[model samples]
Target chain A: METKKIKLPLTKEDVLGLNVGDMVLITGQLVTGRDRVHKFLFNERPRKEEIPFNLDGAIIYHCGPIIRKSDEGWRLIASGPTTSMRVEMYEHWVIGEYGIRGIMGKGGMGKHTLGALKKNGCAYLHTISGAAVYLAERVRKVIDGWKIDDFGIAEAMWLFNVEDFPAIVTMDAHGKSLHDDIEKTSYRELLRLIGL
Target chain B: MLKLRDGIIELYRKVATSLPPDVEDALKSAYIIEENGSNAKQALSTVLENILLARETSRPICQDTGVPVFYVKVPIGLSQVELKDTIIESTRIATEKIPLRGNAVDIITDKNTGDNTGKGFPVIYFEETHDSTLTIDLMLKGSGCENTGQIYKLPVEELGAERNLEGVRRCVLDAIHKAQGRGCPPYTLGVGIGASKDQVTRLAKDQLIRKLTDTNGAPVLADLEKRLLNEINQLGIGPLGFGGKTTAIGVKVGVNHRHPASYFVDISVCCWANRRGRLIW
Candidate 1:
């Protein structure tokens, strides 16, 4: 699809214009959240008023990390991306409520997230999971996070400002998704390969 | 057996509550090595670097810490002081000290541990294998990989070994296809072949602990792992399914003596992070 690579610290305009085939390296604040945090946002009252972080032009990463203790405090040990589909249930609600501009995670989103992306000028990006140790290094700073202690490393919503965060466009505002294209191509190829 | 308050406890607190040594090394590597211009590569580098920074600065890496899945093999006749209690107590200590996010949910009563520890905390699996030393492999198995697990029951009369083999091929392909950029590709593929549903699932999960470069004992299975690895990569599911040839770095199949009645096969896909640590005492 004649892919183009864009370096990040991307603004809302940059993310909004991206298509499904485009690749981006985001360097900025990416607040990390997963099932519990997403659920918490959706379940909390005043859905519009009391959001956790500044949502304008921000990127949300779907991840749960493996954290280790250090003398300074808790350090992010491994935080590879998690499945993005689980957040599909809350993606639309989250984008609308938080004004989220881009979502970075593994896996593609559902119809709700797609619709929200189209309507909200947002995009979905995929990060390499299982590369937590690798990915965690790009984190420049931990801005803030919910102190929901006792929530395991995988479920906590820790926020961090990052640089050159890797991701690929999976879903764009216009309803284009690399995941869909890959699925279709793979299925077609499987049919031909298997002689179905 | 290591005392819950001492040996095993201390180890679990150390391993379960912290990130492995290699994880930090891997993160640093991704941060320094940069040649590919793809955003996907940069994304991986960023994530890995983030892990390093988190470690250096003392912060939780990416939020979802995950449920602690402890695979403990206590040797037969090896009696340690309160092994189960030790494991649980260590989990509590780690949860509090390591400050793991409480993830265990009481099936009937839903609540947060606020300390990442609670009822049925750290799903522990016990196996009495023959040995004097206990082996504890703790995996902060994320839901991303857990979500990729699948089971298929092929009709013995219809599929047979050829189709059984085909079934494995198809299942593995389907997993990669369906996963696309999901399950965080360039993942470790786990295949379980056995008689029942549970056995196959266990086999698949255990396969995650196998070395990334090693294959199963059986020649056929080894060939299958190679074939599947090649085939899945050809799908262009690359690093994060960004259309590359390295979607999966390794594939391992674990088989059990199935009851002659059926061939139940399952596949578990673990993302490249493959967060698992091994401790022996």
Candidate 2:
């Protein structure tokens, strides 16, 4: 497992070098969003100028974190990646419209998103799905939030500064997907089991 | 009654943070079987480490704390309605105190209730029992694993499935194979054979509350459970579907008689977290 350290606002060259199964530790600013946030960006079609943060070369995390308000504004009590498949329908459009460089999530996405990664110069990073506290410790600070009232806390888009956040490149900019490979091999194994 | 409420709240905290003894033991054993430096081993190591960290920090073991489902056995004199209310209230308290993720959402509205309670949330099933004391079993069913659950009708020639044990075996294995890494392996599967669609599904979910080490009372079912567990691990789906040994840690099967025309099999796959707890009072 080759380990790579990537900074925010990644370039095409930065993501293109990554391959399926390579490990990565990302640093700098990352944005959080899940199903509703993706819908808001892709279907609602908000103007880039109206958006609170710059989308160019950004890393959008697929997560609906367990958070609470504290003296420090907001505290991420338990934060882990949600299943990425839920956002698959909107990912292609979002990647193109937002100039996204990477997506961090669990349960690697499907073919459409894999094609979008190749087309848009992006990669899909898979994090440990249930390791909430371990992932939360990597979050240094909550920078800002948007659409809390309409979308609720879980669905709201919150920005954060992270250091050494670990993930694996399951879908790379070269049109490769580890998830798809696993499904195919597993299905073959299943067929053999039933003597098909 | 007050003690029971407090006990339920404490139970929620314990279930959210710690893997039960039986589940932890199964996972540890599964980790031992995986080859060193394999992706499956790496995934299992992270899962074990996360369990320890969650206990130490008093945080939820998974970000998706899951919907709380409770099964209660009570004496005839106990008020089922009041007990249901207590469970609801305790769930609300647990949402803030143990800080469970707000999981209940209205399907039509796409609105999260913020608290874990809503119209049909914190599902509680009551059973009348001869015993005087009340017993409660709780399972935190995560969305990831729940999504992989499925029901299949038997006598389908396509899969060569009949209404017999062989058919049951096929459906169960198919479900596990399809789940792969999506449901978070190594998993514990709850299999319900021979009931109506709704009842069979409930029977499958209810089986999940049993301890991993417990065996089915029926001899035939016990044998089937053992066979399924062995065959599932052989699938090589391993932990997080990276492919290795130890796809499933355990399999529990619960059977009920069904209509002559139907042979339904319902399967509920639980991730390695296997968050469950019991309270007796």
Q: What share of the true interface contacts does each candidate keep?
A: 0.40, 0.50
For model 2, residues B1-281, the per-residue Cα lDDT tens digits are 67778999999999999989989998888889889876667777877888899999999998899989999999989999999988998999989998988988888898889899998898889999999989999999998889988899997676787889888888888888778677777888998887589898999998998888898899999999998888887777778777788888889999898898899999998987789999998
For model 2 the local lDDT of residue B168 reads: 89
Worst lDDT 10-window in candidate 2 chain B: B234-243
TM-score of each: 0.78, 0.97
RMSD of 2: 1.3
- DockQ score for model 1: 0.33
**lDDT by residue for model 1 over B68-168, one digit each (tens)?**
77788888876544666667777676666645555667555545555545766667788888887788887776666677677777653322324367777
Residue pair clashes in candidate 2: none
Give the per-residue lDDT of model 1 (tens digit) for A41-125.
7887345445576667777888776555567766665566777888888889888777778888877878888999888888998
Model 2 Cα displacement at B122 (Å)? 1.0
- The model with the greatest lDDT is 2
Number of backbone-clashing residue pairs for each candidate, in the order shown:
58, 0
Q: What is the lDDT of residue B30 in candidate 1?
A: 38
Residue B10 displacement (Å), model 1: 6.7
